[model samples]
Target: MRISKWGDSLGVRLPKAIVEELRLKPGDEVEIVAATREKLVLQKADDRMTAFTRMAERRLTMPEDYIFDREEANKR
Candidate 1:
């Protein structure tokens, strides 16, 4: 793919074959998982619940004395 100027940033237009293969549609999001001078890897962005589920699977632990302040969270 050839990179072209997009406003102030550079962008690449995916060909029709790749678009169909990936089942990509307008407004769909993709993330660049890895990049180097000669190579780049892209993957579809995960949905919110999928990300949350992955986080849950990690089974992170909190401090025993930690407390959540609902009012503080709500303020954010």
Candidate 2:
């Protein structure tokens, strides 16, 4: 791979082979981690935060005894 100047910062043009190997698509989120001074790793983001936020929008039913510690919590 080769790095090219994009306006100011340098950018690398991912080859078709790499895109297919990593199963990457346009507009997908990726993360870069520096493993060593001469090495870099690229990976897809887990998107856990987005998943948690989506889960938070749903309603969940709790068990009848789920409030067993409510009295203790109220003392705080």
Candidate 3:
């Protein structure tokens, strides 16, 4: 596969055969598990629980009295 310029980023256009074999569709997320000068490896991204685990590892803290307001968070 060849990488081409995509707006401000580089992108590879996956061949139709690989796309069909992987069952990938537009907007599906992928993770690059490994890369080297000669090789690149990609896998499907983990689900929400993995995201939460990574977030927890960041050790983010908030004020004890803080309360989450769904409406405020959803504001555009």
Candidate 4:
């Protein structure tokens, strides 16, 4: 795929075969995974949050009184 200027932003036109194979449309979102300097992989974005909650659920535990200090936090 070649990158071209789209208005002020850069974009690439995916081949018709790959688009059809991935079931991608005009407004579909994809996650770009950069594996190396010359290679970029695209994946359909899943609706899973990959931040703290998922990792915390698997590795971390808390007490029953694990209260969030709302007012203290809001001050920042």
Candidate 5:
């Protein structure tokens, strides 16, 4: 862990490897969530679409074609 003094703010430096592993950039926003008394969650800030995207991805089922069955329509 590296420590640096940035003018008035004291900063703790996170390792580049850890940052890259988390897919975080310098300008990326983060969210700090408090789950338990001792457990604190540090996570990436979620966008409005994050939940929607995951839900859509999870609900995807492809055993058969989802497209219009044009030939079946003509038979009917």
Candidate 6:
């Protein structure tokens, strides 16, 4: 249990082993909620891969080529 000060707030620096166990990083965000007198819930956001894939599947076309005129212009 590493304890450190964050400016004015007394922050608890999570130990390296615990951080690795939780797959947490410096910039990763977590949700903290009071579950009970002793339990504070911390979790990462749900994976959005399925949602994003569905949205991407709905897309009809993707940008590939624009007019194909570059070669002609180069010839000129």
Query: Of the candidates shown, which would achieve the greatest TM-score relative to the real structure?
Result: 1
Candidates in order have lDDT scores of 0.83, 0.76, 0.81, 0.79, 0.73, 0.67
For residues 2-74, write the lDDT of model 3, one tens digit per residue.
Answer: 8899899999998898678777899977888999999888776667657667767997655799887889999
- Model 1 global lDDT (CA atoms, 0 to 1): 0.83
Query: Could you give candidate 4's per-residue lDDT for residues 1-76 as a string of tens digits?
Result: 7889999999989999879887888888888876788788888765445545776889866677887798989999
lDDT of 1 by residue, 1-76 (tens): 8889989999999989878877889998888899999988887676865666776799865578988799999999
Instruction: State the weakest 10-residue window (summed lDDT) of model 1.
Output: 43-52
Candidate 6: segments with Cα more than 4 A from true spot: 45-76
Kindly indicate the candidate among 3 and 6 with the higher lDDT. 3
lDDT of 2 by residue, 12-55 (tens): 88888878887888887778865788888887666866575666
Please identify model 1 stretches exceeding 4 Å from their true place.
Answer: 53-76
Q: Provide the lowest-lDDT 10-residue window in model 2.
A: 59-68
Candidate number that wins on TM-score, 2 or 6:
2
- Residues 1-76, model 5: lDDT tens digits: 6568999987777678768877998887777766788654677777746766776789954457556578998999
The candidate scoring highest on lDDT is 1
Give candidate 2 regions above 4 Å deviation: 48-76
lDDT of 6 at 13: 74
Model 6: per-residue lDDT, tens digit, 1-76? 5568889887677667767877987787566644888566666543455465776899744366745568899998
Please give the ranking of all candidate structures by TM-score, highest first, separated by commas: 1, 3, 4, 2, 5, 6
For candidate 6, give the lDDT of residue 16: 79
lDDT of 3 at 40: 83
Runs in model 4 deviating more than 4 A are: 48-76
Local error of candidate 2 at residue 9 (angstroms): 1.7
